[model samples]
Target: MIDFHCHLDLYPDALKLLPIVSARNLFTLVVTTSPKAWLATSNVFAGYENIKVALGLHPEIAEQKAGERLLLLSCIPKAKYIGEIGIDGSPKYKETISLQESILNDTLTECERAGGKILSIHSRNASSRVLDLVEKNCRKSTVVLHWFSGSLTEAQRAQDLGCWFSVGPAMLRGANGRSIVASLPINKILPETDGPFTTNRSAPLMPWEAIDIVNTLVPIWGIPKEDVILQIRNNLAALISEENFQQNHSDTK
Candidate 1:
């Protein structure tokens, strides 16, 4: 199973769960909320080939952690995945929208300079602006919008910009999320848990539990669960292939 976006390190027993996740052979992308957390999380998961740590500065805390921008940039070359990064325009963070956009712009610019890293982004209520920055700076990067809650038009815009979407069980449970998933191109869809934050029955979801997303997509796509699983796996393979090619090209420069 592939969990394209998750906060693995934030789990209470993350250290203990690492071996379980490895044994399951789950390919998980663990996104950090701040650069300060990136190094420690990266080091913790360094021995696991299937687990990748994305350097990030979540928009919710972008203003509070604004001082970490340079640290984020300095770590770009070593990070092939950048994520949990984007603009959040919910009423709570609306006032800091400008600062969030600036930080996102800088992050994208640095990622472009580092030769296009795979990005797992958070749009929340700011999908349009997030797409704007992504398109303006990292057009060539592999961009995955996690738990996208935008309208079909915005989703189509993202698709037109070559962005991918990561859907999880919590998201699929909602009518709007289901509709959005149905509207998205099947090939561009990936499964994610966004776990430890998204819960099921009041308990935090785990990385391996992302497989549950297949059951949810079965009816939405009108195919059997197996086919849904195969499609998601294929999508992940294709994404990884592109990332590998980009990495190889960057190395040659």
Candidate 2:
């Protein structure tokens, strides 16, 4: 199973779970909330082939940790994944909206220059603005909207821009989830656990719980479970593979 966005480092027993994540060889993207957090935990899972640690600067704290923006730019070359980044227009974070936009612009610019990067972004209540920045700066990067909560119009716009969306169990159970899922092209949809945040039976989920996400999509798409699993896996491969191709093309020139 592939978890495109998960705060693996935020789990209470993160250290204890590392070995299990590795043993299972689960395809997981471990996103950090800050550059310092990424610096601290990234190397811990370096030996695990299936775990990829992304460098992120979450928007909720973007304005306060402005210094980390430079740190994030400098650290970009060291990792292929970039995320937990983007705008949050929720009421509590409205004050830093401008700062978040600036950070996102810079992040997308860097990703463009790098040829390609996989980003798991958070849009919250600012899907249109987030999509604007993405369209303005992104050239070759693969953008995945994490737990998207936007209208169908904006979603269609995103799809036209080649953006992908990641959904967790909670989203699948949300009021607009069904319409959003139905609106999206099946191939562009990805499963994410967003573990420690999404729950099943009142228990915080693990990265591997992403399997449940795939299972959830099965009936939603009216396809066989195995086909859904295969499609999702292929989608992950295609996402990274396309970027690898772009990076290689840039390198050759």
Candidate 3:
């Protein structure tokens, strides 16, 4: 299973058991909430092969602190994606929108230089601005919007730009998410469970729960489950593995 976005740094125990968990061959991309998490997250996945880091400042970090955040992010060479970064219209984060945009723009230069990187974006209430930024700043690198809670038209716009999307367990409970699962192109779809953040549990999510989310879209793909799994896994390899996407996929198979 491909876990598109998760905050593995927040759960220290997950790192220790990774070898055991990865032994079953699950591919997960652990995203950092901000520069503050860069070091700890990188340290956790230091030698692990199945896990990778997606680093970026979250909207909650005030604009005043963006410079400090960017400096910290720049120091982390291990980060492969700029993430969880975008505008939020939710009342709590409304004040953070400007700061989010600033960080995303500053991160774009670094993100673009590392060609073909997979970005895990957060477009909560600002999907439009996210789209605009993707067009202007992130078009050079590959993009994957996590838990995309956008309209079909917004999804189409992303598709038109060749951006990918990851559907989480929430698709099973909501119309918007389910609708996205039903219409998104199969090759561009990656599946995840957002895990501990979803229910605030810390035991860690097994790969099967992620598989269940992908299963909901099986009818939409009209292919055998295995085929869908394989394709998504291919996307996973391409997005998360550095310089060996094809080779990594071959070994996984």
TM-score of each: 0.94, 0.92, 0.85
lDDT of 2 by residue, 171-241 (tens): 88876976798789988877787888778888888777776766667777899988887777667767776
Model 2, residue 190: C-alpha shift (Å): 1.6
The digit string of per-residue lDDT tens for model 3 on 15-131 reads: 665665455446667777667676666776777676767776666665645666746456535566666666665778787777777667666656776554567887887888788
**What are the runs in model 3 whose C-alpha is more than 4 Å off?**
62-67, 76-78, 113-116, 200-208, 238-253
* Candidate 1 C-alpha lDDT tens digits along 2-61: 788999999999999997876664478999999989988988788887788999999999
Give, for candidate 3, the lowest lDDT window spanning 10 residues. Answer: 199-208
The lDDT values for all models are 0.87, 0.83, 0.69
Which residue pairs does candidate 3 place in steric collision? Answer: none
Candidate 2 or 1, higher lDDT: 1
Q: Is candidate 1 or candidate 2 better by TM-score?
A: 1
